[model samples]
Target: MHPAHPLLAVTHPDPYPYYAALAREQPLYWDKTLGLWVASHPTAISAVMRHPAARVRPLTEPVPRGLCPGPAGELFSRFVRMNDSRLHTRIKTLLMAYLQAQSQQACTPQWPAITLLSAVQADRFLYAAPVHAQAAFLGLPDQLHADCAVQIQAYLTALPANANADLIAAGHTAALTLQDRLESHLLAAEASPALRQLRDDGARDGIPAALLAANLAGLLFQSCEAGAGLLGNALILAGRRSLDASTTPAAARTVIDHVVRHDPPLHNTRRFMGNAIEIQGQRIEAGQTVLLVLAAAAMIEPDNAWTFGAHGHACPGQTLARSHAADALLHLLHAGTDAHALASHFRYRPLLNARVPQFDFSKDHQP
Candidate 1:
């Protein structure tokens, strides 16, 4: 029951029990070994997320030589977890055009095909579907979908501790491959009239091209893994509840939200304390790392109803992600197909930062 045992809870598959204990016993307890405080209460969690002193940092700062390795190391170091606010803002702005384009394209005539492909492929076709969807929105060649799928799988399958060196090397190569494609697309977009128009007028202003590209690729990586896991989790939960196809869609959305609350893709976001702060009466030193457990807070907070900002630092993407999930579920439920067929294919792995599930669609679907 020591506060220093934070990793104990993290390593456990279902950390809710541990989180509940921490919430009751040590709402703002600091772990000396981990050099971070666990804020388990809703108020504490919100405070940490919105606090001006809270700043994102690398999971392991000053990344060791030969640790991440090669292209993967370079990309991770350059783009993510560097704690540069100016760069982050720039990237966020630049990607707005692509995000908007994605939104617009989803409503077009091509949507039915894309939706059908997503439904039929489910988890198995994560690479092709998401890439194709992205390509459609970005106006890239659809032929790259297969290559993107292979690269993504390699990246996801890499182990954390005691990982195979060869696998890591493959991951680096995959990242480079995707990076090249993304760069090419960016260059082409700069020259095209339609893409140029969007880039000039629609894209968020003041974003650097490099940062924009990095964030776009990062988004793809995040969404591909999370989206697949969510689809699988939703289907399984719906079937276990014995919900009918008509009701399954709505139930799926509820279950997905619950999953995000109970077992989110990301367990924590690392933030470095910029100034001395007190939480629940304990003073924390500056430069300390604060692990904000969004998933744990979401579960512990009252779920009386769905509302934006229900708890502080509530996801801005909550509405959009939920809407997408709801729509996907509804489409699946009304497909005149057995819902259970898709539910049984989920298999999960222990992800360090997020909960990821492996999906197999070749089980029993008659196509």
Candidate 2:
């Protein structure tokens, strides 16, 4: 197979077979068309992500120039996700400590009453649930969860490369709004344990106040669509397997794990090399980009998929992400709505790295 063959993970429907081909034939081959090295093997992908020399992006331009000169741009520049090892570790420590302190109830969702006709409602609820969960986890006010979710979603949608002009504009506006909200929360003398711990620990750790807000926004941005996709993919799988309310939670968890391995919400992430590194004896030059096929890696190596980035650049919110995903799936399964009822109407949002569901259940559509 030619590396020049289109490997458009985003637009291409069912890229698994293509990914499998790479895993079998060229686990560490460079794709000329994508202008990046593709890492499909667990060992290679882990090495790249965990490598000391591996950078989230080029140090010369941490955040894209186009996003600079704005609040959203500022946040992107300082976000731990894009920073070097030192800063990333600091922020990640503070963030993960705060997240882990949160009670299980805070991150869990109360499943909404659902039906075959509940597709639209399900879509809306799932979209908002993760945002609310994040808000609750951050010790923010429950009253503003709805508005906060919308702003975060807008901000996240405009984050990827080659985003539309309108989307970028909307994201900036939402960023400013969130900035104001977070600033107000910090101003108050009374703070929840989670927020208090974050501020105190972050400050002691030398994390700037402004940087904390930016990263918090970053957390929200990541959670918004990911939560939706996790549930959406699980629903599709459940429907195919004919799972229902009677299915045990343990069984539902198995379904979630399988989906994460096969059809993860975030399919791919990019990493840049800061120094020459060798992966499986292949010399990767400095400044070269490596694409981590997360989904494919998971399928090839089951253990690593569940604990993505376990060694280097671990997802600080991995526990919460898993809990949220499992909760969403359990709720849907317990809703007792037949998966088949929603199968034919399944629709996905057009996103580069994420798979978001957009339900289109009309009044005229019968179950």
Candidate 3:
């Protein structure tokens, strides 16, 4: 039987080949075991994403009920990604405008890039640089970068449907820790304009302080999770192509765009049926799950598909994520080491939606 589970794409080293086969054979099919409809073709995925009947979460459950009464659940409930309400729309607009005002250089690194360039082992730098870039952008203190990453990973692990008890517990602990820290930081962080804006804007919009805190934390979680993966993928691609740090900004941006098109940081996301619908002859009842196979659709047409998302549901942080990744890759190329050396040995963190890379240079003294 064909591997019907989306997690299979996460575990397999090169799932593109499998995705190609599946896309050609069953572009849109129901996986009885998974209890979700998979859409592999670009057109089909786009159709579903923009469909009037599509939603980010189930209509009956606005937030994930399974994770509620805890920090993770609370954050998930307020997360812009999980809601379709008018409040979410207004908040997302404000966030996007804030993100758009940031120049590429503001998001990129210079001193850290130079530091990573001089490391005896670039492996740690490869991972650390992206983490630092994201942390800085989110107005997180440098001292908490490591702890923040750990907590974000825990939350990420517990996001999927089949997460175990251990994962859930860890996520809960991490969420509480993150919540406390974020709240404290927001209260005390008068120096950070972005945080201040989020607070002021949210208040002006009549949003509760707690929800504001959760959304701010959500920004950090997104940065740590997806931002890291995009940077890692760019490094791997540049290493393969022998691209150097001296590459022009325009050139670097092109490479970043290609990477997003070909091997995006996020492979897939799910949507719930908002109303009874017929998609490609398949009758999907309201509340049925639809897996938007972004990676698979990218295989078919990397240019047009909703790699980030579609219509009103698109990720507002796309530009920020790409700029950070491009800057890191430019520096990694200039780091005076063949970063490609690690490309062959690199491994991915097994995640259904994310594609973060993990590297260990201790085993091989490449530098």
Candidate 4:
């Protein structure tokens, strides 16, 4: 059975064929069911991404309504991923340079201590290990990596519009903790040269330490669901290939690369119009949302990292993300995780954009 729409395809057992057709045929069109314009082909997706009037966040609501008037809202708004301002360009350039430099540095990631690598614990590991790796990569102390993962989870839980008061409040607390920790780390005398360079560049450019620190936290935030999907899908591929505890990181990287080209993590991302625009002769009104089906674009151009997005809003952490997933995959296989069993029985989580597998039987079932 095929998914009814691109949105539903995230959890669908097989969506690539459908995505291929969307790129080849539909390209761009209105979906009354979703109340948005869908752009699947590379041409249409590129048109939307290149538009000056296309914004990452909605013009009327820069931050989610529920998160307004709070620390979480402030931190969320500061992230380069969520904006379309000059600040975005400056921070993005600085951060990209920082990541490139930092990738050359050596640091150890603290994998979560799972007493037993059951299906459920593997599910938990999917989210935790990536944050741990990313936090460590950012030059945060080893002891702080696990805590940073916990706080990132809390911050993520509070992002949805329907989050309860408790989650929202915890998110605020987590935001404060993350911001404080990253800021202090950034200012530490023993900070890495890459981090020091980042701080100095920010100061020279008039960017605040708080904003830079929030973006450091944003690096962890970026690693969560999409990272999970990458690692999870790679694990499935390893299992299918009978790669076990003996699989080296290099071998695991081979699987991860295959996943990137095939069962990639993110399926789509969105763009909000600051003004009305026309793409391929179809008019999208001001404030309207356009769904950019990156997976479909990948079907058209398998060589590109379409899942991370493109243009000004594209993710800056693609290389780091793949390396972390490879490391985490190798670690999980060696930890006695039954990759074959996991590969045999799992369901995709109900996410709108990412296709992360959940092994716990209690949650969403296989599509």
How many pairs of residues collide in each model?
Answer: 1, 0, 0, 0
Per-residue alpha-carbon lDDT of model 1 for 1-367, expressed as tens digits?
A: 4323544454454667776667667667777776677776667766776776776653345343443657765555545434445555444444554465556544311122334424345555433334434444455555665566567666555524465888788878877876777667666734444345435642456444554555445554554555544544555566666655577555667877875555555555556777888766777778787766645565566462112333322333344455555555555556543456555555454454445444443454311
* CA lDDT, every model vs. true structure: 0.54, 0.71, 0.71, 0.91
What C-alpha lDDT, on a 0 to 100 scale, does residue 116 get in candidate 1? 43
| TM-score against truth, every candidate | 0.70, 0.84, 0.79, 0.98
Model 1, residue 82: C-alpha shift (Å): 5.2
| TM-score computed on alpha carbons, candidate 3 | 0.79
Report the C-alpha lDDT of model 3 over 178-217, residue by residue, as the tens digit. Answer: 8877777766746467666767877898987677667667
Q: Better model by TM-score, 1 or 4? A: 4
Candidate 3: where is the Cα deviation over 4 Å? 1-7, 10-27, 59-66, 102-131, 158-170, 184-195, 244-252, 360-367
Arranged by TM-score, best first: 4, 2, 3, 1
Report the Cα lDDT for residue 264, model 1.
Answer: 53
Q: Which candidate is the best by lDDT?
A: 4
Which 10 consecutive residues of model 2 have the lowest summed lDDT?
1-10
Error of 4 at 245 (Å): 0.9
After TM-score superposition, the amount by which residue 118's alpha carbon in candidate 2 deviates from its true location, in angstroms, is: 5.6
Kindly list the per-residue Cα lDDT of model 2 for residues 1-367, writing each as its tens digit.
2323423554355777776676667778777777888887777888787788888888677877656678778767777777885777778788777666755334433333355536777677667767777776666766777788888877776777777788788878998888777766654578667777778887787777777877777777767777777778787888888888888878878877877777777777778888899989898999898887776676676666632455666677766777677776777666666766766576666565666666664542211
The pairs that clash in candidate 2 are none
Which sections of candidate 2 miss by over 4 Å? 1-18, 104-126, 245-248, 333-338, 361-367
